[model samples]
Target: MKKLKLIAVLVLFPLGLNLVGVWELQRSTDDHAEYAAYQADLAEFRPELQAIADNSGSRPVMVDVGDGEKMEVKMALSRVTEMQDELDTLLPLTNVMAWVAKGTITLGLLAALVGGLGLLALNWAGRRAMHSRDQLLHSFTRVTKLLPYVLVGHVVVMGAAIAAIVAFEALGAWHAGRLSAGEMKFMFFGMVLVAGCLYSIWQMGTQLRVMLNMFQPTPMDVMGEAVTVEQAPVLWAYVKDLALTLGALPPDHIVLGMAAGFYVTSGDIALAPANTTLTGRTLHVPLAYLGILDEAETTAVIGHELGHFAGADTEFSMRFVPIYHGIERSLVVIGQTLVDSEWLQRATLHPAFMLGAYFMESFDHAVMHWSRVRELEADAAGAQLAGNLAAASALVRISAIDPMLQERLVAHITQATRPTSEHVPVSDLPTTVLREIAALPLTLPEEEMATQLPHPSDTHPSNGERVASLKVSIDDAVRSGTRPLDATQACAAMDRYFAQPDVLRARLTDDYLSHHVQQDAVLVETLRTHAGNVTGDVALHEGARLRGQILIGFSGLLAVAGLILLLAPVLFPGAAGRDPQPFFVGAGIALFIMLCMLPFGVRLFRRAHKTALLLTPDHFVFANLKAPLPIRDIADFNLQVGNVVMLTILLEDNAPLPELTSRSFFAPDVALNKKKRWLMLPMSKFCRDDKKLKLPELAELIGNYVNAGAARHLLQQRSEQSGELKAG
Candidate 1:
């Protein structure tokens, strides 16, 4: 309890109390006049600027009158003041004198802080207990085998450091015959603490290194026989190519699973790394009951998995895997890297550090969800290398093939998300979700949402979006009459992403389903809620731009006020009581008013979300932004790529034009609402437009693209796999 109290004072209370104080302070000092001026100027319109907004998306507008009603400004100011207070309440105080006072309060607030810290630790341990992190642990343990070498290095370095420190201390005390006992005690204690920390780190590193497969060179194909396994002749051909790719991977290991097989640990390998192991791969094929995918499809799967291996993507992750694995293994086996990183050396150190480390580890788990998403990219790269036809089939087959594993995966997914709900009362969750949970769901947004950031903002494209991107890339290459480049080479090159093919099919059906085709109801609802917003925001943003013109016009009022102020001194010289302060104040107000008229800036988060949604209009006519994409711009296309389908509407008369992404593919009806605002389109309205594009016209357009030999070739293998009659 004392340790908990100390932690609360040092960490939790300071973050909380300081933020609350900041918010309260800001609340006390918000300015209202600025807001009213902003609003009133927005609603009022000018004829010259209004036309530009209507025709060109938005117009450069300015208000001629510097005089806005004072009452409106006052009310606006009042609201902003409250908002400021809310903001202040959330701040982590960095103001002068806060450090000492905050530090003092922190020492006392440790109990409250430690409570949440303890809660987080309990939740993390519970989660680890419940999940099959053992598979991951085993995988990491393989990495830990290398830890002994690392431990040796650390021990050598720290031993030398200790000896040097001791020697220096002895030299200083040589003249005194003997060191003061108290002074000697403090020095010994400090050195011992440092030594213990070094030992712990070395021990942990050694444990995790045991799990690492990369530290040792073990070929996946020990005998170097690529044709050892028997299969269909067509499948064999692609497998041969796959073997070559795998052979090139250092520490050569080749694994194949048509569905989900234990081949990773199966063929002459008792302890291959999880990366080399082939359990999950065969599960998809077998569980879905898919007849083996065709040559192209199979090739795609191999290429995709192979891409992950070749690129050393797994190595890229697990940078910290060894550290944690070492600690966990040591904790489980010997019970020592169990000491907290900061407090491990101090015999009297706070237990909260260990608890705090628990949350940090939990947070790492939360972020690891992105690794699954990253797998999707590997999937796409595999498709690209193996050929689109094979990849497309492979993806379709994957969803169908791995039922039990997918179910388990879905369960693990639920486990991962539980941390986000850590704060939710267990009583509130559905009985099923509650039962699966080990502890209360973590309610902290900062940790859960933190991982989501630096994702879309990063140069690495999202895994969810990669399939679409690859499709566009393929279409572009085909149109350009260039042979598709190698996936490895393509990664090293750059090009404007080409147009996407119109979707031929997108529906959900399974063992429990009654319908042949079903739209995602969630998507429909989402589209319904936000399609209106995308439109309204686009319109509102434009309106805001036009209204801001009025703000600029206030500058003219500033000029007039300045003129009035200067002229009043001479023109009203006889009026002894005339004050120039009023004119000058008016001019200042006009200048301030002008500044507010500029375009209302969109928040970065909102923009990022918009980018994620792919919401920017295909062609936008907004203030200072003009982008037009006509339906004639589409070329030979395919909208039937795995799990995605859409209508393609071209806007240009020219053949084989660069694509317009947002406009061409009509949102699949079911998904229209769920992702409507994200796509930033009134998709249904555009898709349903009778005058502009009736169903027959859309159909004819699709038929024309499908009929083209270039597009037809892509489906030659796909249509046959689906047993669907190929339309001429």
Candidate 2:
């Protein structure tokens, strides 16, 4: 009982107290101490009057003490008093309000109360918060798994925001006929704080409203009986059952509400549409969330939300709310300060301010990307909760409905366009999965199988990436040892995970690579890890080459320019004439050029990766974007036959391959570009007599080098690794 009280107080009360503390901080900027001391000095002392002199000390007068010594002591006291008087005069300098003079005692009491409350509350909530944060850190392990990629993403976004700010400042500076970089970043960050604060408030309001609605699972009464099935149990009932099934000890509340799609509490999933109160929550998916999702996608609705529930995020959200609020408040204060800072009015004229703006924008992008990851995590949790059979069933059910009339009056739409839904049975899901437990299994434990989560400072991968992970986990499980998952169920799970568009977008990414490149090329796909399959060999040599190029190019460029800026002046002072400005300008230009080339450089690097493999007469030269790993160094590979053949590139060397593409999107450029383009004219002519162009060894090498490998040696290696009777 004591422990429980401590946990609750720690988790909940501190949050409330912090809200007050943060508000208090917002209200006062002046120095309270200086003002209090000032008031204390002024309370009784008169500036014009002198203290009465005491001549008699037990009749041993000033003469006995030595007249000069007595006078010096009195003068010293007078001087000390004058300094105090001066300090008191400057008391208002430290504070806007004369708090000490105007009821200082009362203010002190109030301050003490607030501070005491905040400290006490924090003591109570600290442990729970730490526990929840640790778990959150666990959830982000996926981010850590792709730490390089995530770090790159953060760099990209933050860099962009800084760039934008710099650009704006440059424009302003150009207009002003002057520029200063030093003061711009802070100035821009100030504006960002203001904007961030506004956004924070808006987001918090949305979050709060959403949470409130969480308690109300069913639709609003305004819709009356038409809102749900007649006499159907309220969504809360489902939440209760689902929580029970999940083995949630003490049973946390389960709620669902989003504009369009389903979502679990904390926006992480724990159930699959198990139960929810719609009253406070938004229902009737908005077009943004819906994005043409047919109305009948009940299982999809549940699966995505439940995935979030499975994240074990209840405690996370409870702790997160306060931190989020604090950050939001900070942003608001910062934004307001930036807007109000007269000093920044001049500072904003600097090109650096524009750069600062760019940095802020990048932060926004990071936040957005993290948000997308949250969505993906939710989707995975939802699928696990719903089960492969059920999730697929829900998708199939949605797919079968008529193309038209999805949002029409409920049953009317259901009656008008229900397709013959085709899907694997629910029983097909691996029985070992255990849909919802009261608590995760003690021996195996839920955390063991959990893909390592990310650290605190990671931008999330997309939903598709997360779902693919779930599939991969199940697949690996099947490969290592039978965990009882049927092929049909696995296939269905694969299909269902792919169905989310949030998972399928192939777009112009940071590398400037098109979606097709992202989808087809294992290298580019690895870089842009939003969605799609990794159906290629895990060729470390190729991945290493790509990563190396990207890292060296980006990291080295900045390092070099920064070093030159600080060194050129020292090395060539005679040429520089001791003017550091020129050197700094040169360094800045170099940095600018490198930053500008980031996307293009990244693309070329990835391009080089797929182009690295070569079937040499001696041995296959496994050169890739990162570097070449010759067949002599190759330890193994895996090959699979499907619509497109797949390979798993691996290395005999200690170095591991990038875990980006686990399969190959191997095909001719033209064939891949179009669905049905072929290589020859009409085939009616007699082939034996007709002369046809043939691929020479060089030509084959060119074609193979243009993309990932499907050459003879590579396949043989794969065969050998599989222990499938080594080909003669």
Predicted structure with the largest TM-score when compared to the true one: 1
Query: Model 2, which residues run further than 4 Å from truth?
Result: 1-234, 248-259, 265-312, 321-380, 389-467, 472-728
TM-score of each: 0.24, 0.23
After TM-score superposition, what is the CA distance of residue 478 in candidate 2 from its true location, in Å? 22
Backbone clashes in candidate 2 total 93
Whole-model lDDT, model 2: 0.34
- What's the true lDDT of residue 109 in model 1? 42
lDDT of 1 by residue, 1-728 (tens): 64466445435544554454344334322322333344344444233334443564333333333476233333343444544443243222222123323333332244344444445444544455334434444433343353334323323333333333333333222221245777777666666765664576455454444323223322222111121223223333444567466542322333222113211111122211122332111201121111223345545655654554444454433233334433443333222323433343322122323433443354355336444544566566666666654554344333322343345334433332222323321221112222232122212221221122121111233322443545634333222222222322221121111111011000011111211012234433444443223221121111122233444455566657656665675778765255666656765676565445322222211221122111222222212212332212333332332322243333223433332334322111112222221112222212221133444554454343223322333334433533432221
Q: What is the Cα-based TM-score of model 1?
A: 0.24
C-alpha local distance difference test of each model: 0.35, 0.34
lDDT of 2 by residue, 271-386 (tens): 22233333222222111212223222333454454333344543443333223323333344444545665553222222122222222332343344444555555545445555
For model 1, the stretches where C-alpha displacement exceeds 4 angstroms are 1-237, 243-292, 311-377, 389-393, 404-463, 472-728
